[model samples]
Target chain A: MLEIINLHARVGDKQILNGISLQVRVGEVHAIMGPNGSGKSTLAQVLAGHPAYEVTAGQATFQGRDLLDLEPEERARAGLFLAFQYPVEIPGVSNAYFLRAALNEIRKARGQEELDPIDFMDLAEEKLKLVEWGPDILSRAVNAGFSGGEKKRNEILQMAVLEPTLAILDETDSGLDIDALRIVAEGVNRLRRPDNATVVVTHYQRLLNYIVPDFVHVIAAGRIVRSGGRELALELEAKGYEWLTEAVPA
Target chain B: MSRAILQDYQALHPQGAPQAGWLGRLRQRGLDRFQETGYPTSRDEDWRFVDLAPLTGAEFRVGGDSPAVRPEALAPYRYPGTECMLLVFVNGQFVPGLSDLGSVPAGVTVGSLASITARQTELLGHHLGRYAPIESSGFTALNTALIADGLLLHVARDVQVPRPIHALFVTAGDPAGLATHPRNLVVLEPGARASVIESYAGLSEGAYFTNAVTEAIVGDGAVLEYLKIQRESERAFHVGTTHMRHGRDSRGTSHSVSFGAALCRNNLDVVLDGPGVEAQMLGLYMGRDRQEVDNHTSLLHAHPNCSTREVYKGILDGRAHGVFNGKIYVTPIAQKTDAKQTNRALLLSDHARIDTKPQLEIFADDVKCTHGATVGALDQQASFYLKSRGVAGPLARKILTYAFAAEVLDEIPFPAVRESLEAVVMARLNARGE
Candidate 1:
């Protein structure tokens, strides 16, 4: 469902992601684990078409469309979603309003009928339960005063409603508590389908335990150094990133 | 002011030579002050940032009795769903013949300054020329000399007007082929409450000048929610001043929104005379093309246990320029005063400009006073976030900028007014493109 071929990207004058390649087939969940300086988050941001990150070389295709050529919003309408690691706190804009705008845009792009406020609220309520959050949070500004856990859950709520064909969850579990991690994982797990793919970017192996991945790739420096099945996550968890970096030649 | 135009215009109205007595004395004193003060040069501190050159060069049209005001002519804004009294004025003179006073509460006298100038001279004397009529500025002298009693509003003590009073001043193409002045005095007696909607509306496409002044006295414990909407014709020029004095425990909220006129200048001067007073001034301005809007606000906290908060936001597009100077003054006796102010500007076009200064002049050492000013474009990241969610670029920026201005609008107490203001802002944003 999603493919990256020799993807190399940079942010301004500094190159961040260098020669990284990965593929996720339908119905499969992939976890990319790496150290602090690793290009794991950069890959997610580049794929989402973040303006800061420049794609020096390589291409990413989602659903047979060249995703790199599309703007961030265009990529989103084409079924590519990026659950931000640190969701921007937009004061004065309510969560429900933001979500409705997003939903209407995507619907319009796909030539589907738009949903009114009443129907949009109904859909949002259903997805709110999937992430274990109530309507109170949406009533306030978008992530204005939300807690770390609430922000993470809000991201999942967006993912569930959009139901993207391919979702890139970057550091979703970093600041989340165990319960929030479980709720976010449950939301992602529920969206799993035979024709959709999910990429979970994390530093620790704990997130993978809750939302088990079919494959795990260890990233170091600017490239993916190792690739293995789900067990590889457990191995990295026991042995810290010290051994993982040593295994990669300078 | 050049040596050529330095000649006093007030010479037309000589010193009590042939006039109507003591009120004649005010006109004479005002004229003398105008001659002595001359035209306010930019050298004056108050007129420092504002350049009166354009206002001076723009054909200085004077008043003359020619074409009569027609009521049916004010078809542009027939504001419906309003139970309040409506006062309409053309140029500077109040047209009682064109107004609809309907059923005003007793003791509440609302009329044009011309009416007071002729009939109720005693009432006009008590407050007229109370403040410095002629500022040290050049334009101030010009307005003093040209003004024909803008409008008069007097609410007796404890008179609670249940409905709003809409004062519509329309600047039309010259009756005498000249400019106009709309000066007003609004005095809310002790314990009185009222809502005033002062609109600077346009009538013609002529390059007319609408120099206006509104002096309001918010008496003891009185609450005034004033909204000034400046939607003048792009061909007209506007220079306005709103001088307000708050009594003990009084509350005043002023929302000034200007979106029209070739060059618009607003001097919102408020002084908290009594203790336990609260004053909040909020405004939003949008400018485009060569249009210029300068908002000069000063809150003088002279008493103790007072609070004042101000927020002014400006959105500049094209090559338009916006100037915002928000100053808060805390005197020595004004202890335990809580004053906070913020001036923000969002420049959409690279060629647009904004000069903002959040001035805090504090003499009370124990008071809590804070001021901040920020000038920048929309948050690119937040716009990207919205765009990434499939919202168009222009719409995303509009949403963000609207959200920014909403912070100031949220301070308004009236929900209906808030809704209308929001709609007006949204419409303005929608009409422009990136």
Candidate 2:
């Protein structure tokens, strides 16, 4: 469903992602693990077409289309989703209003009819249960005064509503407690299907415990150094990333 | 240049027939003050950022014959779903044929200030020019000098007005330098409650001047909700001042929304004269295409245990300019005062500019006061966050800008007025292309 070949990206003078390559097929869950500054988040952001990062060299394709050439919204409309590590706070836009606008835009792009406010509210109420939240959050501003856990759940709620073909979660479990982490994991797990794929970018192994990945890849210095199955994450949890870095040649 | 324009105005309209009465003396005093001050120059502190050349260079004729206005032309300015007392004014003259008194409540007086009789003279004389002193502002002085006809609403003690009072001031005429000065007086007795909406709109895209002053007196334990809507012609100049005085335990709120006019200045002043007074001031101004809008507000806490809240937001695009100056003062006798002021502006173009200042003077040591101001372009992170949700770039920007404005528009209590203004604001924002 997604492919990246020798992707080299930079923000300003700093080259963050150097020669990183990965591929994922339909219905497969891929987990990218790395230590701090190893470019794990950068890769996810690059795939989402963040304006701050420029693709210096390499190619990224999603569903056989060149992802680097598309704008961020175009990428989103084309079924590419990135759950941000730090969700932005929009002071005046209600969460429901924003989500509906997004869903309508995506629906229009796919040649489908847009849902009206009443119909959208029905769908939103149904989706709220997946994240174990009530309807009060929908009326409030988007992440304006939300707690850390609420913001992460809101991201999951958005993911469930948009239903992207390929989703990338960048450190969605950082600020969540155990209960929030379980709720978020359960929400993502429930949305898993045969035709869609998810790439989980996490630094810890606790999140993988709830939503197990089929493939685990450890990245060092912007390059994936080790590739294995679910056991690889357990091994990394037992032994720090320094062991892997020392084992791999510079 | 200002002196020349003033001389021209004085030549055309002489301060006529100073007779033996308090009204005559008031008019004469206003004329004398206006002549002495002429017009504030750029050197004045309060008028530093505003250039008066456009207003002073134009020779405006005062008190012309009322221009013909089609009833259909007034439809866009009227609140359709809202039922209230309606008073219409054209070129500073009351149009009784076009107004509806609409079943006024008992002991509530709703009519034109020009129609006052001997029975209401005692009440009118006490509060006419009490709150808004004309010595400081030449525009206020001029409005007082030429006070002909405007709105007059009075609620007796312990009376609760069943409906809002809407005073619609429409300016329609030839583009030949016509000017109108409207004076509005609202007095609410103790334990009374009322809402007043003052709207100023222009039907003709002409060069005219609208100098208006509204003075409100809220008695002890009274409640007042005042709203001012200004949507003048794109080529018109508007200067308005609203002064309010709150008695003990009184509550008042003022919402000022400005959308049109080439150059507009709004001054809102409030004084908390008694303990337990609460006042809120909310304002929103949207300017585009070289339009200039300035809002100046002053809140004074003269007694103990009073609270005030003020928030003003501005949106400027193209080469439009905006200015916001807010001041909060807590006197020594005003202990336990709580005051908060916030001013925010969004500049949507490279040439759009905003000058915001917040001043606070607190003499009471045991008071809580906070003031903040921010001016910037659209937030980059917020824009990206919206776009990343599959919204197109232009639509994302528009939504964010609209949301920035909705923060203030949503504060309107009346649904009909709020919805109509919301529609107008949305249409205006959408008309500015991507």
Candidate 3:
């Protein structure tokens, strides 16, 4: 479903992602684990086409389309989603209104019929149950004064509503408590389908226990040095990343 | 140039009627004041940022008969869905044929100010020219000097007006150097409640001037909701002043929205004279092209236990310029006074500019007064967040800009008016073609 080959990206003068490559097939969940400053988040942002980061050299293809050539919104319309670590606060714009606008735009791009306000509200209400949230969040401003857990859950709710083919969860469990983490993981797991995939990026292995991944990859200095199954996450949690870094050649 | 404009006005109304009563004396006094201090120059402290050369250099003659206007031309300015009293003015003259004098309830009077001044001389004499002083502003003096016709609203004691009063002023005629001065007076007795909307619009896209003044007196325990909308021609110039006086325990709220005109200045002065008075001043101004919009507000807490809240926001694009100057004064005797003021501006282009100043004078030791100002561009993170959610770049910008403006519009109390104004603002923002 997604492919990256020797992705080289940088922010201004700092080279964050030196050389990275990864591939994910249909119905498979991939977890990219690394320590701090290991370009885990940068990979997700670069894939989402964040304007601050420039791809020095590399190729990223999603469903056989060059992802780097499309704009952020076009990439989104092409079934690419990135759940941000720090959600933005857009004051005076209700969540329902924002989501409806986004959905309509995406629908138009796909040559589908746009939903009216009444129909959109009905669909939103059904999706709200997946995140265990009530209808009040729909009327509030977009993440204006939301709690840390609420923002993360709101991101998941958007992902569910948009129904992207490939979703990149970038530190979605950073500030969440145990209960919130479980609920978020449950929400993500429920939305998974046979034709879709999820790439979870994390610094710790606690979130993986809830949403178990089929493949685990350890990235050190912007290069994937280790690849294994679900058991590799538990082994690294018990030993630590220092052992893996020491074993890899400089 | 200043003398020529004043001379043209004098030539139109050659002082033939014998000056007899207080009304005549008031007009004479206003004329004298205006003659003494002509149009304010850039050297004046309050007029530093705004230059009046465009207004003074033009030879705009006053007191001209307006051409006939079709009903369709007036539809855009009227609140069609809302049930309200309608009064239409063309070229500063009341047009009864075009006005809809709806059946007002008992103890309420809504009619032309000039026609009813003779019958209610005592009431008009006491309230007219009371709140807006003529000595400070030349535009106010000029308006007072040429106050012929406007809206006159009076509600008796304990009367609650069933519907709002909408006064629509349409400047339709040859816009070549035509000017109009409209004076409005609204008085609500004790325990009375009312809402008034004053709108100024133009039909032709030419050079005309509208100098307007509205004075409202809110009696003890009365509540008043006043809204003023200025949507003049792109080449027109508008100078308007709204002065309000609140009695003991009275409440007043003013929503001033400016969307058009080449050069516009709106002054809102509110005085809380009695204890337990509550006043709120909300304003929004959107400017584009080379348009200039300036809002100057003054809140005076003259009594104890009075509270005042003010928020004024501006959205400027292209090479447009905006100015916000808000002053809050707490007198020495006014203890327990609470006042809060905020001014925010969003500039969409690098050439767009905004100058904001918050002035606070608190002589009372026990009072609480806070003021803040912010000027910035749209948040990049917020824009990117919207774009990532499938909204295009241009649409994302429009959404953010509309959201920034909706903050102040949401404070309006009238639903129909609020919805209509929201639509207008959104339409204008979308038309930016960003």
Candidate 4:
């Protein structure tokens, strides 16, 4: 479903992701774990067509389409979603309105009929229960004055609404409490279908307990140093990233 | 040519005309002041950024016979709902057949200024020119000198108006170089409460000028909300001045929305005359093409314990120019006054420009006042965030711009008004193309 070959990227003068390669099939969950500034989040952002991260080298393909050649919006329309680590606070835009716009945009791109506000609300009401949030949050400004946990839940809510074919959750578990983490994970877990894929990028293995991944890759200094089964996350959690850093070739 | 225009206006009435009396004296004073001030040049501090050459160069004749307009033609501009008394005017003259007062409650008088009878003369005389200081600006003085028609609203003490008053000014004609001065006076007695909406629109595409002034007095403990929306013909020019005076413990609010006219300038001055007063001023101006919109607002905290908040936002596209000058003055006796002012502008094109000046004059050390101004394009990150969710680039820009303008539009207390304004804003954005 997704493939990245030597994905070398940079922001301004400094390079971040260098010669990173990854592959994932349908119905498979991949977890990319790394220390701080190991290009874990950078990979997620670059795959989503973030303009700040220049793709200096390499090619990426998603569902047989050139993912690196698409714009951010084009990537989204192509069923690629990126749950931002820090969801932006867009004051004056109601959450319900934002969600409806995003959903309708995706629907229209796929040659499907757009849902009216009333129908969209009905659809959103069901998704609201997935995040254990009431309808009041829909009327409030998007992530304005929201707690850290609420922002994470909002991101998960977007994931549920858009229903992308491939989603990259970049450190979504960083700011969430244990309960919020469980709710977000459960929401992601329920949306997993045989044709769609998800990439969970994080620093810790606690999230894997909820939505267990099929593959865990340890990334250091912009390169995936090790690839193993899900047990690799537990080993890294117990030993810390220092052991992985030392094991990587200089 | 300049002298001929004012000379022709002054020639409309004879000197010491018996019908004029005190109004004649007031008009004479206004005319003298206007002649002395003339049209302000860019060298003047207040008029530095706004160029009035297009407005001043045109030879706009004084009021002529207003063209007849059907009541149904104004249905679009009318606010939805039942709690409003509609007063329609064409060419600055009240259209009685189109107006619907529907038996206003006792102590509440809503009528045309030209129709103020002998019994209501004292009421109009007391509050007409008191709040609007004519010596401050040439436009106000000109409006005062030539003002002969507009809306007159007066509410007695302790009387809460059950319905809002809607004053609609529609200019319908292709009359070349036509001009009209509309004057409005609203007086809410002690403890009285009411909301008033003023709309300025044009029925035809013509080169005309509308110079309007509205003076409002909110008595002690009273509450007044005034909304002025300008949607004139693209070829027309509009200049409006609104003055509000708040008495002890009174509250006042004004929302100014400008979206039309070749040249538009609005002056809003609010004076907190007594303690415990609250004043709020919110404005949104979306200018495109060659349109130029300027808003100058001043808040005077004359008494202690007064609070004032102001937020003005502008969206400029194409070669449009937007100007905002917000001034807050806290006097020595205005201790403990709290004042905050913010002006933000979004420039969608390289040629688009915005000149913002925030002035704060504090004479009292105990007051808390802050002012800020910013000019920039839409946040690329925020835009990308929306676009990343499947929203296209153009839609993303529209959404972000809409959010910026909503900061002021959301402050409008009336949902119906806010919704209609939102539609207008969206249409304006869409008209700019993808």
Could you say which candidate leads in TM-score? Answer: 4
Which of candidates 2 and 4 reaches a greater DockQ?
4
Model 4 residue B120 lDDT score: 79
Stretches of candidate 4 exceeding 4 Å from the true structure: A4-22, A32-40, A55-60, A64-66, A89-154, A171-183, A202-209, A216-250, B1-16, B332-335
Cα lDDT tens digits for candidate 1, B297-346: 98899999998888899989888999998888889999999998888899
Docking class of 2: acceptable
lDDT of 3 at A228: 97
* Chain B TM-score of candidate number 2: 0.95
Candidates in descending lDDT order = 3, 2, 4, 1
Please name the candidate that would achieve the greatest DockQ relative to the true structure: 4
- Candidates 2 and 3 compared: the better one by TM-score is 2
- TM-scores of the candidates are 0.78, 0.82, 0.81, 0.87
- Model 1, residue B207: C-alpha shift (Å): 0.8
> What ranges in model 2 sit over 4 Å off?
A3-23, A30-47, A51-70, A84-161, A170-191, A200-250, B1-18, B68-71
Instruction: Tell me the tens digit of each residue's lDDT in model 3 across B345-364.
Output: 99988999998889999999
Q: List each candidate's DockQ score.
A: 0.50, 0.46, 0.53, 0.60
CA lDDT, every model vs. true structure: 0.80, 0.89, 0.90, 0.88
Task: Please give the lDDT score at residue B303 for candidate 2.
Answer: 98
In order, the first chain's TM-score in every candidate is 0.97, 0.98, 0.98, 0.98
Weakest lDDT window of 10 consecutive positions for candidate 3 chain B: B4-13
lDDT of 4 by residue, B27-65 (tens): 777888888888677888888887888888778877667
| lDDT tens digits, residue span B291-316, model 2 | 99999999999999998889999999
Q: What is the lDDT of residue A134 in candidate 1?
A: 81
